[model samples]
Target: MARMIVAEMCPQCGSLDVRATEPGWFRIEWDRRDALDGGWVEHLEFGCRDCGMTWD
Candidate 1:
């Protein structure tokens, strides 16, 4: 079986605490940022909660 490349680790702390920065229950308005930006501007983002780093 061929292994697929999934993600690039966080550079700062080298922690795997990275995931899609989703809008939680309290902040439904956060979803609007996606539409305002564009098709994939803030919609698909990677965030590392470990060091609190978020990026597109």
Candidate 2:
């Protein structure tokens, strides 16, 4: 199971006990054959149950 990192403010009630509802994503990057190969990037989106705020 993944761990949830709570935020400082609740989007809904604007409380301090903001809860993390979901885990976004995990990204891994590797070197290609050349420098022209763009590096890979990953993002994780977290949702707050209080105000339903999501960050990616």
Candidate 3:
């Protein structure tokens, strides 16, 4: 059997139909000369379409 991976889901409606507002991609800087050495991070403000629940 194949396993399914879900990235995000609505907590209120328990629905997979979710949208992100003001999504941003950021890199962690740790006082390093090379910024590439830091890891990449994602910031998302999710909102549920069904229940209109928003969260960071």
Each candidate structure's count of clashing pairs: 0, 4, 0
Off by over 4 Å in 3: 1-5, 23-42
Instruction: Give per-residue lDDT, candidate 3, residue 50.
Output: 85
Each model's lDDT: 0.66, 0.50, 0.72
Clashing pairs in 1: none
What TM-score does structure 1 among the candidates reach? 0.45
lDDT for each residue of candidate 2 in 1-56, tens digit (9 for 90 to 100): 99997556644566564444325423334354234334433434456665677655
Model 2 scores a C-alpha lDDT of: 0.50
Measured against the true structure, the TM-scores of the candidates, in listed sequence, are 0.45, 0.29, 0.50
Q: What is the descending lDDT order?
A: 3, 1, 2
**Of 2 and 3, which scores higher on lDDT?**
3
For candidate 3, give the lDDT: 0.72
Give the least accurate 10-residue stretch of model 1, judged by summed lDDT.
Answer: 21-30
Better of 1 and 2 by lDDT: 1
Per-residue lDDT for 19-54 in model 3, tens only? 876565444446652565344434669998888899
Whose lDDT is higher: candidate 1's or candidate 3's? 3
